[model samples]
Target: MIELREHERKTLLIVERLDGKASVEQVINESGLSDAAVMRAALTLQEKKLVKMKEKKQTIAKLNKEGKLYAERQLPERRILDVLYKMGGEALLSNIPKEVDISSNAVSVALGWLVKKNWAVINQKKGTIALVESLLTQKPKKGADEKLLELLAEKDTVVIEELDKNPQQAVATLKRRKLVETKEKSTYELELTKKGWKLVKKGLEVAEEVTLLTPELIITKKWRETKLRKFDVTASGPAVYPGKVHPLQQIIQRAREIFLEMGFTEIRGPLVETAFWNFDALFQPQDHPAREMMDTFYLA
Candidate 1:
């Protein structure tokens, strides 16, 4: 006979009803339990040789802040290409900002992308940008990055496994540009073991076992009627990191304590001091190296 905790029993029954195989998400929805609770019970079942758990790696892709912004306003390179086309298919590098609504800081960034995508070429010696001869005869179409951004904007997120070749290839470039972010997540599926099937056939009992003893239970004498769950003391517990003072702060505190013990009074001073008192009063000359910006901290 197998005696199981309520949550463990519920998870096992759901897995059995799911035809001996079900994802953790499916069990979570059907069992009405938190994912953590469900996972804990599933692990316990696995330890008892009642179930086998398998993990699958899934890559999920989504647009970040920059990606979302570019999706709505268009990419910096595409915007520059439009400006170049309007400027008779060429313009001086410095003249790009005047022709486009792009920021001065983003001009260089856009120029780099334009050259990389082969939409435009940079004449470094002439300090000018010119569209590719092929693009001069026809309007340039959207690239893979642009298409992928639009798709992510519409769907919010996409599973990498489901993407077509072009968009899938664009994911790597978009990731490098910080426009998109991808996360690798693990999804678990549970299947009943042979021993699990045998136990199910013989039937099992769900028991409420006490893993903790509280003051209320002791006061009410209810502990006498409840079964105390067996515990394995040798099993490792969750890691604990107790907070302590920072090393620098500890050193400062010890120094203060030593001074106090030596009959020195501790006092607080102004955080901001004028240069007259900070440097001049200390006899530091205007040309003194200590008064240099690199050597001293200054208030903005």
Candidate 2:
């Protein structure tokens, strides 16, 4: 006869009832056991050579903050194209903001995507943007990225396998643009081995086992009636790394404390400043090398 714990016995019975093959979720629902508990029992059964476990990996996609916003409002490129179409199919790049509600920072991004998707063209020397002539006659269709965004908006999460039209490329583009995120998910399927079936044909016993000996149990003398659970001392425990302050933050804090001890008062000001306040107001010449594009970091 094979000896089993209560949860293990329950899991095996459910697997057998499922025709010797069952998914972790199926067992979880039928047995009313938590995911972790079911997985633990499955692992123990595998260790005893009673069952075989197979793991399948899948990619799940979800929209991030930017993706949600873009999905609600049309993408920047799409909005720009609509505005250009309204302006007789051509407009100066600087004049687009007056016609559309897109942000100044997003104008460049929209322009890039417009040219990339062949929906519009940009004249860099002339500083103008024009929609493709074909778009003027025919209604433009949504790109794969746009379609994926709409799908994600309707449903918060989607499995990559369920998507059509070469989702891998679309997912990669969305991920690069910081609009969508993908994570790997694993599902386990358990099947009974011949040995497992033979054990089922014979008889098995499940006894109440105690993993911990508490003071109440000791006082009540119940420990004597329950079987103590077996432990594998050779197994390693989970790795732990205690948290500590970052080195740079530690240095900054120490400097602040030292300045306070020296009887100095601390003052705070805005971390960012406009060009006038940062350079022009300080009598810095516009032609100065420090103000050049390559030397300076400019915010859009």
- Full-model lDDT, candidate 1: 0.90
TM per candidate comes to 0.61, 0.63
For model 1, what is the alpha-carbon lDDT of residue 293? 88
Q: Highest TM-score: give the candidate number.
A: 2
Worst 10 residues of 1 by lDDT: 199-208
Query: What C-alpha lDDT values do all the predictions have?
Result: 0.90, 0.88
258: Cα error in model 2, Å: 24
Judged by lDDT, which candidate is best?
A: 1
Clashes of each: 0, 0
Tens-digit lDDT string for candidate 1 (119-163)? 999998998999999999897789888999999999999989888
